[model samples]
Target: MVDFGEILTTVGDFGFFQKLIILALAFQNVLFPIFFCSFLFIQSDPERHCNTDWILQADSNLTTDEQLNLTLPREEDGTFSRCQMFVPVEWDIGAIREYGLNETTGCRDGWVYYDTLYDATIVTDFDLVCDRSNLAEVVKTIFMAGLLAGSFIFGPTAESYGRRRTTQLPVVLLLIFITVAGVSPNVYVYMVSQFIVGAALGGYRINSTVLEWIGVTKRSLASCMSQMFSSVGQCVMAGLVYAIRDWRRVQYVLAGWQAFIFLWTPESARWLLGQGRTEEANKLIRRVAAINKKKIPENLLDVTGEQEVQTHSGNLVAHLSKYMSFICVLVILRFSLNLGYFCLILNVGKLGLNIFLVQFLFGITEAPAHFLCVWVLELIGRKKSLISSLLAGSFFCLLTLAFPQGEFHVIRAVVITALVTTGKLFLNWGGSVCMVYIQELFPTSVRQTAVGFGSIAYRGAGLLSPLLNILAVYHWSIPIIVYSSLTLTSGALSFLLPETRRKELPDSTHESNTCNNCI
Candidate 1:
């Protein structure tokens, strides 16, 4: 009996048909980050200060700055305090200014915003600053929590229901959840919607059987191309933020964009074969064969020894028991890379550049990073590529500490952002290639399941990234140090992973166990 892998090789696995599937699925990859990182723009807290209208009313002659000085308390460095005001007094504003009153308290008449870039955001509209500022991060964490839950749900389904249905399920759910988030009546509703959106994204990206559609040899190329679209999505999201000042409109635009993906995506023929639906699998395979202008021998169509196909699902527990250690390394790598990557992304505003430009730069960098990742993976192989990328990312993180953060604020921001961007770029560059590396590390029977295990770490780090932003406020260099340490440690551990540079993919547990470091 011909195994499905042999049939795929016969059908021209990386041909026109696979390319169409890759292109359709790339949209999903793009949408994932838009939802994941939407908080950067949508929940941004702009500059604010206590309302001084009472002082203004008491002295009509006072200028805005003068009113601010008399009513708004000043910090040690002399900037107007953001959350406190002078206690109400019987003295006129002129008397208050002349006497220099010292008593201060929180604003009783709400607050005022000035010089804010966004017309509306969750922070400003919901007043999630000061004591409530942490809620912004809480909502962000809620999304990651959903993703952790999804990693479990989608993995088995991707194996059983097949990749096409698994991919479509999340896209449909994303559309629904994001729409609810856009129209949410309050922060409570929005946070709940964000959680569901996270779960959908986790299901899609983590359990991605997208790479399984093409030949094992072509997996790197397809992943590179799709991730380029992921980068493209990042740039597109920045443009969306720039054009649509209102956060709701941005969410709506992204939700509307997924409609095309819901309509056109194709199922994985390999998955169909695994489910023992050879007839249905061949129907799709024939379309691929036609697309590639290839022909199959009539006898090759008959699939027998179909016992393995029928029992693949039941075989997972047996497969994983032997491959647990290798999967653990991958899970750790996922956590480390994402923790550093997202730490920088979630704090883009603090980088001291035009928020749109900084975000656009972050997105644009990933395109080249994906391409570069593929090239490096081909040249040096997976093990060295990850080590080199991680080590360099660590070095750059330390390099940021040496940057002159004195007085020239714009110059300082630009320099540090450049360094941080390079650091994150390499982490992601290695990460893109690592997907193929990890997938190749396992037998075909349990590849999606292995990916699910890694996504747990990936999403867990995502959950931690927003809370990690708190470290930045205590000291800018602290997050850089923490991220660098994690990447460095993971890089050291990566040296122990077996390289899969140019080998045929193992098709079963017996083959994989004897491969990698086993021999």
Candidate 2:
């Protein structure tokens, strides 16, 4: 009898072809953030313009040349006339003038009109006063909540239905929500769409499955490549935001791009093989081999399952009994890292930096950080590397708190940005290490459930970070302190974890039991 499981496992392992797919799958992650973050540019309040009613008034009488002379160099000449423009005449100019608006070159000469959109009685501030007040934060919160929900859903679904179906399911759903979100008529509709997008994103099971398919030797490289792709997504997102200034339009573009991904992407052969569908698995493998211009191994094509047993058969209680502790640690660490990283990224304007430029710089810095992680993982090993990075991040968070506001804003910005970026690098590395660690720690009977439980921490953190930011308004250092403490604690706890450097992945209960220290 052929040992089909062994052959499938060996053939499905990572190779040059698998690397290509991992790279391709990365495009969606990259695009998702780009589309999502683009909204920041439109909704930004760097100059606190959210409540301002500055209508560019064109002078109908003035010729084009005259209009050009009055306007600043940056304003588009076609839209406004040379004439003075003001908000509704009823607005209180007394307060505006008190702020030195009347003394300014633009305000005094009637070249620019500035009016406060806030009415103490009517309530005009959309983010703070209206139904959608703090809509951006709400969107982020809900999106992450959906991810938590999706993470649970994807694990079993992928294990049961195969990785291909589970992976493709989210991509389709992402496309749908992205389209709807782009043209959302109101904040409610937009938030709802974003929630769905987050849910769909949660369903994706490709990263782990893809890594599983590769050889152990290539796993770290493949995982690193995955993080690199996420950075690429950030960079791509930056460019897209620059092109599509409108928040809704950017969402539409992202949705459309996700839809395009279905064209060439393939399902995981390892998943099919695991499900006792060798023929189907071989078919998918052949397709990959074709793309890479390599011949499919004859023995791989003849693979068969060793046994037929129902894999994912249990409830929350059963999963908890097996892997709750592991899940808790992962969730706690992921949440802390995400809280600090995202709060830093999403609240760029609050830091008093050029929002776009800062985001651009953040994305650019990831490249070096990623490369450094690859190098560090090799030189220092995963435990020390992750701990050091988290410690450094905590230190920088303290530095950010210690700096006096306003005097050295630029220097503060650079240090915080660099530290945060570096921290993210370590976080990514730690996450990958944890993923492998958890798989080895759990029994195959409950592996997916265990991983899902761990992922909840990640999604849960995403949901909470935005709320933390909102609270940071009152005490900015609170969130940082919380994040710093959590990271330092997680780093220390990691020391207790047995190092799995260069060990073969554990499969059976006996193997897992023997490697308890590593777990």
Q: All candidates' lDDT scores? A: 0.77, 0.58
Candidate 2 lDDT over residue span 79-101, tens digit each = 43322233323334344334322
lDDT of 1 by residue, 126-199 (tens): 77777777788888889889998888888766766767787778888988988999888888999999988888
Question: Between which residue pairs do clashes occur in model 1?
Answer: none
Candidate 1 stretches with Cα past 4 Å from truth are 36-38, 42-45, 49-110, 304-307, 310-313, 404-408, 516-519
Best by TM-score: 1
Candidate 2 wrongly placed segments (more than 4 Å): 1-14, 44-132, 205-209, 262-304, 307-320, 406-408, 439-445, 517-519
TM-score, structure 1 vs. true: 0.87
**TM-score on alpha carbons, each prediction:** 0.87, 0.76
